[model samples]
Target: MRYLLPGRAAWAVSLTRTIVALVTLFSVATQLAALSVQPSTATFSLDTTTLTIPQVDYESAIYYRDGDPYPHLDFERVDRRRTVRKDHTAVVMENRYVKLTLLPEMGRVYSFVYKPTGHETLWQNDLVTVGGAANDTGWWLWIGGVEYTLPGDEHGTTWAMPWSWEIIENSSRRKAVRMRVREPGTGLEESIEIAIVSGRAFFEARICITNPTDGMVEYAHWVNPQWTPGGQNELTDRTEFIIPTDRILIDERWQENLGPSPQAWQGNPLRFIRGWSRMGDVMADGLTGGFYSAYSHDADEGIVRVFDPDKTPGVDVWTYGYHPTQIPMGSGGPNAGYVEMWGGTSRTYPDERWPLAPDASLQWTEWMYPYQRTQGLTFANEDAAINFQVTPEARRVVIGLCPSGEWRGAVELWRESVHDAADGRAPLRRWEVTADPATPFIKVVILEGLMASEFNDLRLRVGSDQDGWTIVEAEN
Candidate 1:
């Protein structure tokens, strides 16, 4: 069955749907205008609450080594105790589209909820246990979320420590919280400001790292997000990683289990978490785009991260692999498994460290959001995300978009060979709508009985009338 909407002949059939969509758009636009007028009144809110969680405590023996400046914990002699209830402070920021929760003590975003779908995009561990070997500190605390690491490699030095935070911005358009921590091990100060704004679906995280020492220091910074976009707090066979890269360097530990280093990303089994039989870590060698995502086909939901490739060039994927038994000890329950998407200043941990001059600082901005009904993602940028698929076998074309802000735009499809002639011709198809991040726009067009080669050379573009700009364009 072939279906088309807003076409010359099909307009009458889709009139009712068009009216309903316009009404919804009008309502949203009215609300946004009201919010803009009342600058003092905030549409978003930021507050703190106490959370009682179950955690297993451990007793550790501390020891110092000769010629070593920092003390280390003896994980070999530590004793594990029974689980107990503990109270922690949770900072929450909410808007109409999403709700974000952060734990200052953990120095990470504990939860990110997309209000429209009622799905938690970040993986949260049920139990907090302390175990596992780290690069600098031998032991690591196994509480999961979006953890920020800096001044050191492999989990950093402040993930488990307390951080000071304050409300930095509160207005009708935006609300944010800044969490700061001074690393005692490296004498560096790190702060991350997480913000949620009105009329936007994504949350922004701005990170700043300052070196106060008299001598130059080498350090590594990474934002590690453990994602379970399916909302089940687990990984499934259908979960796929979308990294726009040509090659990947598999970590040495997984070389035998997976394959050799520097393998092509396309046609590689590493794209899916289920392809691996054991735990592994892989780093993208060259990033062709500024964004990456982890999408689940079963749930039709995914997490997208947008950042500047010039500033934060590093991207890595780590998975606990498949099955309950493969889940690392002290991290989560039997059903707990997640894919960790890491973005940082350096490509690989410990192997490549960036140098920070004395009294110098580095800063960058990144946005994270949850998207749905896209089937998959092909391209993404600061303004919008696009999925353009041409299924010649099915004789169909699908266009999906998730915009960051309110947009009044037209999606146009053009046959390049015909459109590029001396006399410019009109598009083959055009659909107009008012869309925002909360309301994603998707359209499927049937080619009918046309041959596949007829549409092979095509261009898809999203043009915004309000801003007089082209949001995104893709050619297939």
Candidate 2:
């Protein structure tokens, strides 16, 4: 088994126009191929950032606009509504008598989806932010979906904010989900892919962040995956979270919002029980279950759940279902909690928490799995079931980050002790994460060879849990 790192080529911003030319050329070539096969739209709308396919198609299932305002692809009715929340924005459009709404902040969809190929809508309410803020809003990155419905999860914002989406159908059967963005200021393009085949979904999403300018650029990205209506409660249970031993950040505001919390509670700022949640103490009181978490599940409807090692830990994982516990807030909203990729959100924390990568490009990985339920399987046994084997020849990366100042590492996730997707039990704790990194180098855990169905979606959640984590920064 080879643990060799994979091939990666990067150019700093100092390479100047030469690098730009090369990147532009490469980007152009890729864009051209994307454009070449993209289906022509009858009408396009700038107001909603939409391209509608009027049940008519000619080219492949790809659509290309190059971050530029889409010119054509005729659609009627462009509407915008400003909510009471200043930071909230909504764009609505309709075509083929179908209405679509785009809520920029909400984490994801949680309703029903109409699919000729049998597609279902997941959660309807959206996450405001991992840290929960209606203050400064980030850009809304929507992957490709042609049709979006305003009504699904029936959330409060489901009416005001509404659900927004895009679609792409190629003659080729391969499905892809990701509408990547190249930050207008710094042309660092980050993207992801999601698809549904044979009634199941798979994902491969990422940010190919390039610092094209002369100076170093810092940025952070979140892996957002919407779970089904039952709530990810089932998934949150029976889960294990793994990460580098670093100080974790959390949301303090959530607690103040919750007011008088339970006496039984011991606050771990980095924990999912942000100060804001009684965590359904009235109902599940002594247990970790929330009404929402209780409703979510990770089991297959009837058949056995499968496992794959390479793509997911097979057995070991970072989360079961995304629970309020994963975030400090009793509510599992956007502001709940997440991770900080790269050097973007680190310094916001206290202490010597400077950029871990500084001027270097460090790489890290996180994976998810939906395998067969083997309650008491050993690592070796579970490893094989997941087809995950990290060998010497397998591509590997030795990423280093600065671990100065306030740093912490946490593995918080939710799970269902009861396999019922609707059992509505809060996630059960399955593992204890005590950091004991001997040489400042935590073992890079990789679950390899994961098949598409073995996991639902590939979501690498990025946000400062509370403040941020400090790695052994990349050294010269």
The clash numbers for all candidates, in the given order, read: 0, 105
TM-scores for the candidates: 0.84, 0.31
lDDT for each residue of candidate 2 in 1-476, tens digit (9 for 90 to 100): 00111110111112343333334334422422232133232222212232121111211222336654212221111111100111234333222111223333332321222111112223221211111111112112112111111111111111122223344432234333333333443333333232322212122122233344556554433222333312231223322221222223322432343333332322223223222233211111221110011111233110111212122111101111234433321112222222111111122211112222323432323221122222211121101111111223332212211111112343211221222324655421222223111111122333244433322222111113464421111101
- Please state the error at residue 324 of candidate 1 in Å: 4.4
Worst 10 residues of 1 by lDDT: 1-10
Which segments of candidate 2 are over 4 A away from where they belong? 1-121, 126-135, 138-173, 185-187, 195-201, 226-276, 279-476
lDDT of each: 0.72, 0.23
RMSD of each: 13.1, 22.2
Instruction: Give per-residue CA lDDT, model 1, range 1-476, as digits (tens).
Output: 00111111211224444344334334423432332233232347777777655544443455667765344665544433334556778777777677778887667887787766777787654545555445455556656679888665677767755689888888777888899988777788899999998767788999999999998888888888889987776776689899889899987777987789989887688888778777778899979889999988888778889999988898988776766353432322255488889988897754688899999999999999888777778787766777887877777888888777776788887765433424767877888967776678888888776688876766776775456544333324
Candidate 1 TM-score, C-alpha based = 0.84
Clashing pairs in 1: none
